[model samples]
Target: MALGFEELDFQQTPMGELFLRRRVEPTLGADVYEVKLGDEYLMSSLFTEAEEQLAHLGLAPLDGSDLAVLVGGLGLGYTAVAALSHDAVGAMTVVDALPAVIDWHERGLLPVSAQLTGDPRTRLVLDDFFALMRRDPEARYDAILLDVDHSPRHSLDPSHADLYTPDGLRRLARHLREGGVFALWSDDPPDDDFMADLGTVFASTRAHVVEFANPLTGGTSTNTVYVAHSAG
Candidate 1:
């Protein structure tokens, strides 16, 4: 809550005009921001918890076999950076809807993402995530991580709702390799029906509750990550 560094303005595509500032305590990890006009805080470079959660959940099924990871949405590049860290990962495909966010990384507005953007294992795809997945029936990935919107229930884009629907789940299931994982990040806990839908598509499903210390807001904030795996 206390002042840490000079405040700077960042321009997002659909969101537009974001304020990024360093956190005094940084309990969340390192860098944190209070986005103007929104209650949701932005985690920048200090993304240890989120990155670890993505990698831990996505890589659990792979027994060191080379696998391809498809990551939807490259926010702060926490998940992409984390997925690329695994040597068993043969490739990482990152798809983001907003070109402005991608430009920010290319221009170095977001340092964490910029680093991963330059990584050799990464392939950047600028497209609508849902459309991209829908068009690629033959494409298969060992793990697919989706962190596009804030949460499944509260999406910045109305179109994101389709991703949680039964039809969307079916398309997602088609893109997975045997025993592959599908991970989604949600701001709040997942609904029972949402979990059930995931179960229908994947042979197994699990939800992970991630708790992290909030520097600006006291106490702890928890984000739910839903992980589902295809039948081997």
Candidate 2:
């Protein structure tokens, strides 16, 4: 029998203190895993619908086998796992700024860890995803799924702000193959201004409102998934 709560791992990173914790939710009567950065909750197993949707909606537009995918955040491995569920996805690269986060998945601390780490198609990279987008990459991807920041208007670090801009988005678009899809998960509601910027860079853009049950709250909650496609 596991204890009610346990801290799986803790690390001091350049960003802040990162913590991985597991606790039994009395209501659900199931073990829940969570990640916190500093005092802010980064991810929780309790709510994963939006994270998984980021992959499904992102890859849906793409049509081709042996597709290469890039996932900007690896939190709880939900997005990556979801992306791999598609038979079209041939390879997936998951990038995270913090090594501790990757270690958690590698060590099988998270429930979806095995689904990510055990799959030969998955490659876990320790790198700043925003930085990777700023420069030209060695190769282009068929789809890029990002769930790093809170939103285009809010970010964990100021440096990440650029990626949301039109100019920054242009840089990111260059890394994608023609007709490639870019999908982002935002905690904030859809931003019209951000949608306009996305339109400027991509051939088309759409914001999806993903609703999921909130265990903490009795009612449902929503997150935005922005999907854009490069010019064909």
Candidate 3:
């Protein structure tokens, strides 16, 4: 078989140039899909273990018959797909700041697009997640999964920095129903100061480290999933 490299789509957004590429990796013997902003790699289908784990660990504590979930980002549709996997999840709204990301899925350029969009429980919304959190919505959710930025301190766009602050976290908590759960995915290890701030806004807070094999490095790196349960 021949190694295939194709640029699926490209767009110029407020953030930067976003492009979706699908390549057949011969070394790994897999077809890899990736999203790039300028020259920086945003996400890839090659390594999605941590992304799926983020949803699993976050939704584990919720024991409800019909659950409503809000996912902050829809990178490659991994998180939204994982959230919809739960039988208890009656409805899920995935919101992303970048319209191009959402467009990729609707255009069927992404691998998981069909499964994610076909599911009746899923809804894709293009909006600024942080701004939406600051204001009160008509409804509250049972779980909120956030994977918009790299980490609390390090952000892809400087504007997202405010979401991790104490006041910003409180805004997020207000949008959740009583006893709701808030989860965040970070490429770095858990931060003590951030967790301390979570304690102020939430009743219970903890960080989960997800370790997976790195194909290129032949070693393991960890991703942290920070979880905070509502005080009510």
Candidate 4:
């Protein structure tokens, strides 16, 4: 058996080992890009429907002009790019904890990197997203799209676990303007416990299940996009 891909880059982040890989999927006869942390798969080009939907569903509900967005977790840049596709979006700031992931975009290792960096409205910030939200008490945004974790129940890092808590979610609300939207991508289905937690922080919250073809398996798979709003 020959190798289907090669490791283009790898980094030792505080959380674990981060790997960027390009592989050929013989089943579908297409090239697939993947990001892996340790032995766990974080994201892949093969399954990007939910990531894009996080932006679509979140931005679709907004009215008026010049929307400001903050994308938490740079992942493969799918959500950020999708958010920018909206003409009403005036600005977007993508924040990530790992410098190596940001470096991957700066180096043009991914498809959406060029689009995100070249656009005047987009700004990529290297920082811990949760920490930044907590630190910037006066800063606010129209929308904040988070793709940092597997789910509210399954986090990549333990510190990130706090973001799903009531205190942490309130911190996110602080950085969002009145009537602002908060959206997040989860690889798992919507969790009732998490949705209940979200209800405690925001006035309204909903979960969208995005379905896409599963090339590996015979049927389809689904991911969840959770959206909430800060009251006016």
CA error at residue 75 for candidate 4, angstroms:
0.9
Q: What residue pairs are clashing in model 3?
A: none
TM-score of candidate 1 on Cα atoms, chains taken together: 0.84
Estimate the overall C-alpha local distance difference test score of candidate 4.
0.89
What TM-score would every model get versus the actual structure?
Answer: 0.84, 0.98, 0.96, 0.96
Better of 1 and 3 by TM-score: 3
Lowest summed lDDT window (length 10), candidate 1: 28-37
Candidate 3 has an lDDT of 0.88
Q: How accurate locally, in lDDT, is each candidate?
A: 0.74, 0.93, 0.88, 0.89
Most lDDT-accurate candidate: 2
Per-model C-alpha RMSD: 3.3, 0.8, 1.3, 2.0
Two-way TM-score contest, 3 vs 4, winner = 3
lDDT of 4 at 194: 88
> How many Å off is the CA of 54 in candidate 4?
0.5
Q: How do the residues 97-190 of candidate 2 rate in per-residue lDDT, one tens digit apiece?
A: 8988899888888888888899999999999999999887788999999998888998999999999999999999988998999999999999
Candidate 3 stretches with Cα past 4 Å from truth are: none
TM-score of 4: 0.96
User: What range of 10 consecutive residues in model 3 has the weakest lDDT sum?
Assistant: 1-10
Error of 2 at 103 (Å): 0.8
